[model samples]
Target: MINPNLALKVLDSPFHHTVIHNFLDLDQASLSLEALAEQEFIPTESDLFSYSASNNLSISDNPDIKSLYDSLCSKAWIRKLESLFDVSLSGNVDMAAYVYMNGDFLLPHDDELDSRLLAYSLHLTPNMTLSDGGSFDFFSSNTEGEAKEIVKQVVPKFNSIVIFKVTPESWHQVSEILSDVQRFSLTGWYHG
Candidate 1:
């Protein structure tokens, strides 16, 4: 249920990233949303992030979402990502469901990790606008290599996906949710 032909726009300036719309079939997406709705979200708070997230969703009992997660970690999807980012992926992933309720936000930081080669988010917040304030942002660096400010903002759109190369310059953050509605997403890192 994947659309391999969807526009994969690459932005290299602020640490490589690709934005993809219509990432999955409508039916599959609905299954994911249903599974997410049944899961218990735990509050996760840290100096770096504050939000409610499900425990590693890969271990979930929901066959639909689990099957979808398995497919995303398959060789086929890895190849698609490789073609888009022009980098190899080891077919390993760490994923979880996130719910950013009102005022919940993740502070700015590079998702640079030795094991992670790419970071991604499959957004499921439908009908969200910029005014909603729960957007995904990628930060650009100043000439001195310091993270300056956000260069791109991807609004929470249902069934869209965003993937970024995990370099030190891959700093990014989730803006605080201003609206009363929860911002939902299934996010993870592709490891190499």
Candidate 2:
């Protein structure tokens, strides 16, 4: 695993940015879903969009998931976020899986509530095409608080994970899925 300490400089820099790598172990990570029929976790209507005021998925209170969440939190990657954001993360883990079919998309928006301090997403499916429009986009802002430019686009790959500050400035969204294949991922937020 890469030390998240190296990402501190990037996180604290003035420009908005994102980190991408295939290192997270989702098979071992705990999962909870909104749909019971899906077997595997799947995001609800609210979870699929960024504009939703609240998520509809319920996380497992099970110890295994809690242990996995705790282990990941101890990793250098999460520690780097703690240092960069100047916030200590605490409380229960709220997570859900996202499965997008063709034409599915999440509109651009910032995370809400003081409760959600940080956000992370781990991709699980593979063989996705870049042109399929499922990439995550990070935006830059001007002094006046307007979107200045798209600073980066992180392509979704198997085991690829993205961690970012969840303030109003850390604005991001997912493009529409253009392929027939399903796009699967585990998405969640950490509270301070």
Candidate 3:
């Protein structure tokens, strides 16, 4: 179940972002993790990123995956997000499961895509530490909105959801995974 008194603690140094710990109840989070393991993930690579990812969860047949997606689209959830982020949403959300093993990494880039008002990652990797790598690095941007330097690093925590406003200045990347333990997460964007 969604945490009723979820607090949106905003981070403002490099860019605007927010993280909510224990976003889901224990049972739901465990079930979601199990469902993710059951999905088919394909190795995907580009000049920007290298990771294994399943297709969009919006069309997933798995009941747990569907439930998770449905919960994000629910009016209550949307309203909560809208209130926290201070933005109007169309209730349109896109999500996919990702697994980054050792050597996988994503290059820096701003998520300024069409209609993508906010981006999020629901971390499922338990007991992950800095030594495990796959940390989310946020970069500071120049006056012209170009990525400058990484100003902060957020280590993935279990059952935590990190959301950030998608803008030209929202430059961030997933650092290389240095351990055999895979970094598992549900990541996507909420459209306006």
What is the TM-score of each predicted model, taking all chains together?
A: 0.94, 0.71, 0.96
Per-residue lDDT tens digits for candidate 2, residues 61-83, read 55544444565556454666676
How far residue 25's Cα lies from its native spot in candidate 3, in Å, is 0.5
Model 2 steric clash pairs = none
Q: Over the stretch 2-54, how does candidate 3's per-residue lDDT look in tens digits?
A: 66767767777676789889988888899999999998999999888999999
The lDDT-based order of candidates, best leading, equals 3, 1, 2
Badly placed stretches (over 4 Å) of model 1 are: none
Q: What RMSD does each model have against the real structure?
A: 1.4, 5.0, 1.1
Tens-digit lDDT track for model 1 on 1-192? 566567667878677887788888888888888888888899988887889989998777789888889878878888878887888878889999999988899988888878898998999877999889889988888776667998889897998888889877788899988889788899999988
- Superior by TM-score: candidate 1 or candidate 2: 1
- Candidates arranged by TM-score, highest first: 3, 1, 2
